[model samples]
Target: MAMFVHVTSAANAPRIRRSGIRAVSHGQGDARGVYCFPVLPSYTLTHQWLRELARFGSRGGLVAVHVRLDDDEEVLLGRYADRARNAQATVPAAQAVRRIAELDDPRGWEVFVPRAIRPRELHRIRTAPQVAGWRYRPDAHGTRPCTCFGCRVRGGYGARRLRERLPHPLDGPPPPVRVLLARVAAAGEPGDPVVLREVLHWFGMRRRGPLDRLAHLAAHPDPGVRKDLVWAVAGWSTPGVGDLLDALADDPRDEVREAVEAVREPE
Candidate 1:
């Protein structure tokens, strides 16, 4: 009963079925489009199909297409959403990577995921309870470079230079290097300090430029943050940095005061 505006191939129909989508006859078209019954796959299967759809959609192909899911499909998406939130197994994470690779089309992969799952999933897999604590699969290491901002910033030219650069996870997160630093510096005054501190620390474990930004952050409002910034900057020791430290020589906070003294001390 539910029909596509365009005639679909029998092959495409099966593909949809295999994809955990069931076509339900809802007496015909609905106001939204076509209403089909949902095919509920295990959470793993749902994750797989979503990744596949995203990857496939990203490929420059076809046109703007709307996929109308039946009531069942909507319910399944919610179920998987819940499963994803509560997932305690690396199996789900590994499945995520496998499903993405299966898509073959990076553009399409971007099109289907939750934005977070596409790029960050690898990281999550690496650190999560299931994958991180248990095993390391060199195969699952994502030969493709992560397209997320964090990966680009941390990986630098190395990630770009690599032959395979995967699309970002659902088009967001792992923010770009410049964007991350700018937001960090702007935090609290016109932004949020917690977000700034979190990102700064995240950068600390990754690359170098973030430290340079930190040095200039001595003027930050939070004394503790300023102290951390000073420590990060001291690693680089640029010209006139000594003078900058000298200016803060009398800071009341012991940490800031010590940083200023250490930075200004004769070599």
Candidate 2:
């Protein structure tokens, strides 16, 4: 959420008193810091003005005046349509999603994404300044996960861990585990043995992977890694390569038994 500061009552008074307009600062820690733009008869007018203020296009007035959607508007108009529909709201107070019908009907918002945006896809609307940060782009810092299971295992750990365990090239100081984890997150399969094993090891670095896969590896080769991996793989209990896991479960290896016992505690 964005915060608007240095706001005066005059510029915002019209919309503030109309339509019971509200501004929510999503990033602000304190609720008291949230500014409520009261609704007025001139709500549409104030809304235009607030939009200008948010865009820094307002002429010489109300610098940094924050404007945000009320709880219902955010939930309804801001992509939480399912939640809004599920919520029982009065007609006037409910989200005016029906108004959006006008958008799809001939001439509307006209802003279509290059790809189909699913209902579950999160839509983040950012201003020019916010979008200027290329750091937020995917693969900007090479954080993209490797799709291959071997690559995922190697990528999830730093170059050092990977060098010790696997047959992959190790460049200088290892890339941060975050970059590797992101790669794994994007490409690592839920049930692949190498991906699952690497994910388990990576959790010790405080990175969690797909849970059920980790649970399947509860009887993995390494004991300590399994302990932390279990937490990451919580709520997923699907059986995996049972023969492999069962073998690890019955293995004479002390490390293997310890890890399996830790994960199978509640089961």
List candidate 1 stretches off by more than 4 Å: 1-176, 185-191, 202-216, 261-267
- The digit string of per-residue lDDT tens for model 1 on 1-267 reads 111111122344333433423344232222112221111222232222332223223332222112332211111112222333542122232343344345433221111111111111111111101111111112334464455553344333444444234545332334567877767656746346577666655454332444345555567667766665555455443555555566566676888898767765789
Clashes of 2: 16
What lDDT does candidate 2 reach at residue 158?
A: 58
Please give the lDDT score for candidate 1.
0.38
**What's the TM-score of each model vs. the native?**
0.29, 0.24
Candidate 2, residue 78: CA error in Å? 26
Q: What are the Cα lDDT values of the candidates? A: 0.38, 0.35
Q: Which prediction has the highest TM-score against the true structure?
A: 1
Candidate 1 TM-score, true structure as reference = 0.29
